[model samples]
Target: MTSPRMIQIASGKGGVGKTWLSVTLAEALAAMHRDVLLFDGDLGLANVDVHLGLVPTLDLGSVIAGRARIEEAITTYEIPSVSGAAGGVKFDVLAGKSGSGVLSALTRTEIAGIARALSRLSERYAHVVIDLAAGLDQSVMALCTPDSTTLVVVTDEPTSLTDAYAFIKLLTLQDAEADIRVIVNFANDREHAWRTHAALTNACKTFLGIAPPLAGFVPRDNLVRDAIRRQTPILFRHPQAKASEAVRKLARDLLVPLPKSTPGPVLRRGA
Candidate 1:
């Protein structure tokens, strides 16, 4: 069996629409008839469920506490038909708990256990999207792995740029060869996005000796806000929105076609 391509979406600062992009990207890929698994790595402040307007009784915290198996903590969302498809898309979501410092309090053993469980789950899907917590905390850095693709989401603000650089610097120190990508969010236009990407790419090249390529940019659109308020993904609620179109294009460009599964044992829960 082939392993899933794990993409970790991280932001140096909070409220930069990391969760929104993660969920929307998952929807976009699932719409392409690719199996996807969305993991809310924002641990204590998991907002993926809120963005999807779902109230999950179990989350990653539950599994970490040994109250439920990893499979039991997984939730499913039936994406309504789009593109005139006859059937809907089915994707798995592993939610996060909402409690102050709940995730931060987890021990190293507990964190490693979760990572191992995620690795096991990845085998069943073509892509695994992990919405990691913001900043350069140990908890956030612990999730970085050689096999995972890390996306650093940044905005036009100076603070956002500085903090994003700090996060990338810290990550490279740990794994210099890590597969990293950049996504400029809230850009005014293509030129604006290019400027922001250039600034970040140049700094990394000069200082860290590494430059992650720009995957794409997501424009500042009002439809994104509306979808958030209504607990719907813009990709599903308004596919015509500029932000949604960009996300769909980005997913298509970044995610590769799944390799043919070899003749071997594979475990799929809730298939």
Candidate 2:
């Protein structure tokens, strides 16, 4: 089987729905019967567990500290059915240590060891969704590789746009051929989303000489907040919500079809 496609979901700023998109995309893929691994890549302060309302017994810290194997710490997330059926979509989640500021102090070798381990583990799944830390920092860049897809999430806020630009610029510096994609969150409508994407792309084309495609947009929706409050995925709790529909569509658009002779995984990024 082909190795899983690694997707790094990142944002220029926090609170732009980076983790939200990452976990939901993983769920969407799992709902489609794709084996996926949703890794919480934010080492400093892991929030995937918090958002999902899961209390992970272990996290990346366990793997890095040699206390647990990568597979040992994985938590399972099952999509509940309305009728409480036996079969439902399920996926694996590797959470991050909550309040582990020391993770940020990890040496390069330690980080590389984790990356290699994750790379090896990814071969077992079709998609590996990584929720990277916010900003264009070393923690974010460490997960990036020639084969990885970087999804940069942005908003209409001025700081969000500027930070998104900086993140993309840093990726270019690291790997000019990096596959960067954009997802405009909190957009008022399709027009606003396209406008935001165009502005960012035009700026990159003028200065950095790299223009990543606008993968899609997630319109503003209160259901997203409600789902977060309940620690449930909007996709599962409110599939008909505007935000949920948008994410489902985005997930489908990003999932590239593989040839029967050589099937490959689907990965996505924003920026």
- On lDDT, the candidate that comes out on top is 2
Off by over 4 Å in 2: 1-4, 82-87, 257-271
**Index of the highest-TM-score prediction:** 2
Q: Please write out the lDDT profile of model 1 over residues 92-146, one tens digit for every residue.
A: 8998886545877776667767888888889898899999998887778877766
Model 2, CA-based lDDT: 0.82
> Each prediction's TM-score against the native?
0.89, 0.90
Global lDDT scores for all candidate models: 0.81, 0.82
In candidate 2, which residue pairs get closer than 3 Å at backbone N, Cα or C atoms, i.e. clash? 150-269, 151-269, 151-270, 152-270, 152-271, 182-271
- What's the true lDDT of residue 163 in model 2? 91
Candidate 1: segments with Cα more than 4 A from true spot: 1-4, 81-87, 256-271
Our model 2 lands, by Cα RMSD against the true structure, at 4.3
How high a TM-score does candidate 1 get? 0.89
lDDT for residue 118 in candidate 2, whole number 0-100: 89
